[model samples]
Target: TLENIHELALGIELAGVRFLWALRKPAGTGNDEELLPAGFEERTRLRGLVCTGWVPQVTALAHGATGAFLTHCGWGSTIESFAFGLPLVMLPFIIDTPMIARAMAKRGIGVEVARDESDGSFDRDGVAVAVRRVMVEDEGKVFATNAKKLKDLVVDEGRQEQYIHELEDHLRRNKDV
Candidate 1:
């Protein structure tokens, strides 16, 4: 997730909903506190921030009650976000983040924050606005609704089998091509 983690950590307070953030352990780069804001450290408990290396990253997304995602707009994360039916607070920080954000925005599965016209670094205020928009705004509610609808289509029991068969058939057909 992006800086929206802060707003999600705070917004749930106003709406009486429970919001949790699952932070992953660094694979190659150690704990990068520089990525998170200074004051955010206080949320170690209140936000249910879990920093662990054991569980798969997708576990949190698949868990029930995960209403939305605050993501960096990376392709893998975007696909997982859709698979989990969680609408996003899309923040594109590097490389293809902006492109993925635009695509997700078009799908009505997420909202993107305005990037700096010059440098593209997002400050705390920008992060807050984006997260609040997704977590509390009317458009955000619509996005969440649509995202869930899409998820149902993807996870439908009948369709799941059909999709698997189709994938297998396609792979077999393209074995050489």
Candidate 2:
């Protein structure tokens, strides 16, 4: 998720949106923050930075002010975005990330940066381009609209309870059989 904040910040800034990249300086991990390339900070009109943990990060993302999620495409984060009805700016860092991006794209959940396999790098330019595409492009709005619809489904208590009860009954019947 730390990488997510970093990756998203670039895109958010490029899309002319206010942005932040909150990170956790892991205990004794000795990994320095891989800073944006020279001049990027100035060019992108960089905003604030924070060193925070997961709960607070999720809290931040769920806040009413949060319009979208620029995330790493972890299943947990993906679900969280869905729960909050926040459209995603997915940047999958793992092998599964591309898959998640593809699926979410289909469902109008988010967008991912294109990878350059030759260098194994997502340079600032690429990140900026992807961010704009997802945040400002028409596809981004479609993703957000779908995300809101999905969130409504999740928040419908009556539907949820019905589904849960049905699941429980089905389980009980199977156990008896």
Candidate 3:
């Protein structure tokens, strides 16, 4: 996984795109400092950020400057992206991720990055192409539009209050029983 991160960094560089990468180190040791390829930072100095710890996902997603969310397709991330109306660069790994990727694609709200195989292995070029397609090209705009509409559905005040009332009713009914 670490190796792929390096390759993706290289790919991101090659694609000539600006980026912000929030990285976490492998868990085998206590060190939290990310061990990205040497000079990766300095080399991409003009175009990228490689933050080495926890990042504020909601804040980042909400920011006007953020275009797409390159993410692991974890449930929390998927929902958050939808709520924020940010188009997704779905990189699903682990349980239910593949399904989520497929669903998002089918829904017209995101694009699933290509993998080397169905099992989800990938290289730098694939990462580059995916990023470019989402962040730099024409087709990606459709995803962005759809994502905004999806976001509007969630943020609609009437819809939100309805859900809250439904939850309160359920709680009250349960309390009486």
Candidate 4:
């Protein structure tokens, strides 16, 4: 896990884009500094902010300057990112997250960081490439457009109510089953 964190840090640094990283320190780690590569903070000080405490995720996502979300593709996080019209750079670790990541990638709203099938390990290059694809490359525009469409659907009260009603109807029809 520490190695993964280190690789993420290195990859984000290599991406060379402004970033806001909300890093929850590994359990039993004494300080945040202990979690990062040497001189990473100083090297990225001008373009990055690494917060080691609890962050207001929604607030960050809603900020106008925020470009894309680097997430683990949990349902909640995925929905939140979509609600804000933010493209995703996904690094799914477990459970249904990998499936969610794949679905989002298929929908063109995100890019999944590649990992080793044998060890499930990802490197700095993968991280940098995924970030750059969603943040710097021209392909990012397509992701942004798709994300905005998803956001519109997510924020539409009428559509939401329709979905709820549909779900209720389905449940009623299946109540006997």
Candidate lDDT scores, in order, read 0.69, 0.70, 0.83, 0.95
Give the TM-score of each candidate: 0.67, 0.73, 0.85, 0.95
Backbone clash pairs for candidate 4 read: none
Model 4 agreement with the true structure over 33-131: per-residue lDDT tens digits: 478888999999999999988999999999999999999999999999988999999999889999999999999997999999998899999999999
Mark the regions of model 4 whose C-alpha exceeds 4 Å error after superposition: 28-33
- List pairs with backbone clashes in candidate 2: none
lDDT tens digits by residue: candidate 2, 28-129: 444665544345567755454434444466787788877777777888878778788888776676778778888988776766676668955564466776
Steric clash pairs (candidate 3): none
- Candidate 1 lands at a TM-score of 0.67
lDDT of 4: 0.95
**Stretches of model 3 off by over 4 angstroms after superposition:** 29-34, 164-177
Error of 3 at 21 (Å): 1.1
User: Candidate 2: what lDDT?
Assistant: 0.70
Worst 10-residue lDDT window for candidate 4 reads 25-34
- The candidate maximizing TM-score is 4
Q: What's the TM for model 3? A: 0.85
Candidate ordering by lDDT (highest first):
4, 3, 2, 1
The reply for model 1, stretches above 4 Å from the true place, is 1-19, 22-39, 48-55, 157-177
Taking every candidate in turn, the Cα RMSD to the unseen true structure, in Å, is 4.8, 3.8, 2.9, 1.4
Clashing pairs in 1: none
